[model samples]
Target: MAKAKWRSVDGIVLLNKPIGLSSNQALQRVRRLFQAAKAGHTGALDPLATGMLPLCLGEATKFSQYLLDADKRYLTCIQLGKRTTTGDREGDILTEESVPSLSDESLESILDGFRGEIEQIPPMYSALKHEGKPLYEYARQGIVIERKRRRVTISNLTLVSRTADTLTLDIQCSKGTYIRTIGEDIGEALGCGAHLHSLHRISTAGYSPENMMTMEEFEAISEQGYEALDAHLLPMDTAVEYFTKVDLPETDTMNMMFGRTIPSPVSLDNGTVVRMFDQGTQRFLGLGQIKGTMLRPFRLVNTSEFSL
Candidate 1:
């Protein structure tokens, strides 16, 4: 049989990644479903974790970085009393300690210490690079590498529920905040040990869980034909909806498209990033930054499909 044909499709697909599949595995499956010529995922989720995995197709990949830098939300369950090598249920038990009979007040007090800005040492069994190799590779060989502590913000951390041996939390954190580390730290604070039993991302970059589509849903839609699948693709501009918008005249839009800086028609702060669009045509031009009272193009979208 011949290889599958690829087409230039542009848009974002908010995928509800299921557990047990790495982010890349999920992306490839969705790419094949859409038959997209080019595709990429904004962020990665471990095989044991699941949640919203935004897939960018064609030109949408150009703006994927914006989403990567945005905040994330997750619901995590921690199994207290046992510490693990990987800080998760997948790791080997490193230590076992008796869990203390804890009260809401005491647990809340310990969690408050972790809120706001704090330092976290990256886990050894992680994708972080060490001398051009992943840290997990060294971890698999029983080689431990020293890692520097990086600052991350925990914007919101609230106790969702709890049982005798387990605690559930709803977390809203900045980019690079590891839920596994949070679980381990909380366990330590509680005078017991803990590891992430399960984690589910609820939102990221302003996209909520309700916007996500599961693989089964996408597969069912695929059977209806390509149009049905394409209908689920969000416009590329959705990636930068958080930025201020700056509409330009046709002439300035053309100039910016050609890499020339044009005088800003709107009053915006210097160094402000803005989403650019053609005022008359209402077509998205790209992204620009205000510098010295001029709008400089940072990234311009391919406009072959647009009449502008």
Candidate 2:
């Protein structure tokens, strides 16, 4: 059969990623479904994780960096009393200990220490590069490579509930945090080793899973054609909606799009980034940042193609 022709569709889709597919694998599936000429994902979730995977198609891909840098939240279950090679249920068990019966106050105190800023040693089973090779490759070869401890902030960490051998947590953290590492550290503090039993991203980039389109749902709507699928996508500007919005006159909009810096209509702190838009129509132009007193375009959309 002949391959379908790809089209230039633009927008964001909030997908409730099912467990077992890597982020890139999930992205490819969505891209083919939309038949978009270009597509990207904000960040990768472990194959074991499920939920809130944001897929950006066409011009929406341009704003994915903001989503990548945005704070994220997850609901996870940390299995106590076991240390695994990969730090999750996927890897082989290296050690096991009897989980201690503890009071809520004691468990809460141990979790508190993990809150705020903490340092973590990236796992060998991760995609982090070591001498241009992914760490996981070395892990597969049984070669223990020296790793460095990197700093990350845990904005919020709440103990949701606990089972006989599992502790469930609701974690909101900054970019670059590895929940697997957090699980190990928390276990060590509690005098029992631990590994992540399950992970689920609850939200990121100010978006939640409540509006997500699941794969099961998409399969049901698949044969209805692309226009039906398009109805589910969010406008490209929604990715950068957290930034301040600045409406510009037509002349200013043209100048900004053409890579010219224009005088600011309203004063904002130097280096403050804003979303640019056409004044009268409120059409999104792109993104601009304040330099000294001028608004310099940083990332401008192709107004000729989509935005007027």
Tens digits of lDDT, candidate 1, 1-308: 22259988899999999999999999999999989999999989999998999999999999999999999999999999999989999999999999999788988988999899999998888888999998999999999999999999999999999999999999999998888999998899887889999999998888867889999999889887778999999989999998898888889978977889999887888998899999888888889998978889888888766666
- Give the Cα RMSD of candidate 2: 1.8
C-alpha lDDT of all candidate models, in order? 0.91, 0.90
lDDT of candidate 2 over 173-192, digit per residue (tens) = 98889999999999999888
Steric collisions counted per model: 0, 0
List candidate 2 stretches off by more than 4 Å.
1-4, 306-308
Q: Name the runs in model 1 displaced over 4 angstroms.
A: 1-4
Q: What C-alpha lDDT, on a 0 to 100 scale, does residue 147 get in candidate 2?
A: 89
What lDDT does candidate 2 reach at residue 274? Answer: 93
Pairs that collide in candidate 1 are none
Q: Highest TM-score: which candidate?
A: 1
